[model samples]
Target: MTTDAVDAPSGRSASFTVLTTGYTLSTGPGVAATVSYVTDGGRHVVVDPGMVAHRDRILGPLAELGLTADRVTDVVLSHHHPDNTLNVGLFGEATVHDHKAEYRADQWLDRDADGHALTPSLRLIATPGHSPEDITLLAGTPDGVVAFVGDLWWRPNGPVEDPVSPDQAVLRASRERVLAVADVIVPGHGAPFRAADALL
Candidate 1:
């Protein structure tokens, strides 16, 4: 809804802004999910492109900011779940990044530090649990480490325990790991939250 930019960490010339389409799905009253877009310099970098039907709602906000789908350089998926990855193919010009086990493959970053460097300031993290191949995008900007944790949790409400998840224990540990470092949290299915508030 807003075009808010964050200063790139370590004095990189290019700055980026992360805008979410708020809550897309209408599963129930108060049960809405989010699909996020990161404007890294100029190209649009999207994560967890929710439902295919909600494509316009997601892209519409980006268009308002002057970035378009054709400029999306990477469609980084957090997991194989349809709510998160099914619509990834919509970004025809972008490469989909995730572990091969769950969905499409190609740019796989196996380790935590091996993030897919979208720009000098932004990258992706392999955060599994919601699914074996789940990942999160980490943007090192002046605001702090902004984590786009798809399916890792449902924001202010907390973690999800779906029958599909391989290991909730690992998810718990990953959440702790992420919270310890992240300043801003953009959950898969809710509004953005502060990591500090979640820790408390």
Candidate 2:
């Protein structure tokens, strides 16, 4: 699965806030996916509104930011895994984006998400390995480019390799692709970390 380099979006810059930091417990197989809120002008995008200790863990921060579920304009799912997509229906009015299409209401617009710009500063790119359908959201911010990479990495230090990745080689390639452009990374089940400090 060779993919082209992800080019940074030009012009505008978006802002992001982690609604809830996530975790994966080594014992009992417990996990919660990190959820984020990104603001690119009028586009309020939520990335991976997955499993959480409570729904408020996902919504409380939004309220703190003066937003409601309906205010979210877009919802992005990195993949269709249950842990990463459990709360998708919360944003009923949002246009949902995945690796291959834009889903809104009754319309399923077939389109490649790679390099698909949701705004001048926010885009999606294909970065599969943890799952064949995985995609990462790239946001151009004032500080630098932030890559919201779902499970491509569990965290900065990592398992060094994903235990469940279908193709280790492809996963390694995807990590390199992200490292080439990202200044910071919002990993799948952890807080954001500087790309320079990654154990990759």
Q: Top lDDT: which candidate number?
A: 2
The local distance difference test score of each candidate is 0.64, 0.89
How much lDDT does candidate 1 score? 0.64
- Per-residue accuracy of model 1 over 125-159 as CA lDDT, tens digit each: 66687777777777766667787888787655664
Predicted candidate 2 versus true structure: per-residue lDDT over 8-72, tens digit per residue = 76634799999988888862258999999999979999999999888999999999999999999
lDDT of 1 at 101: 24
Over 4 Å off, model 2:
1-6, 27-29
Model 2, total clashes: 0
For model 2, give the 10-residue run with minimal summed lDDT.
Answer: 1-10
- Per-model TM-score versus the true fold: 0.76, 0.94
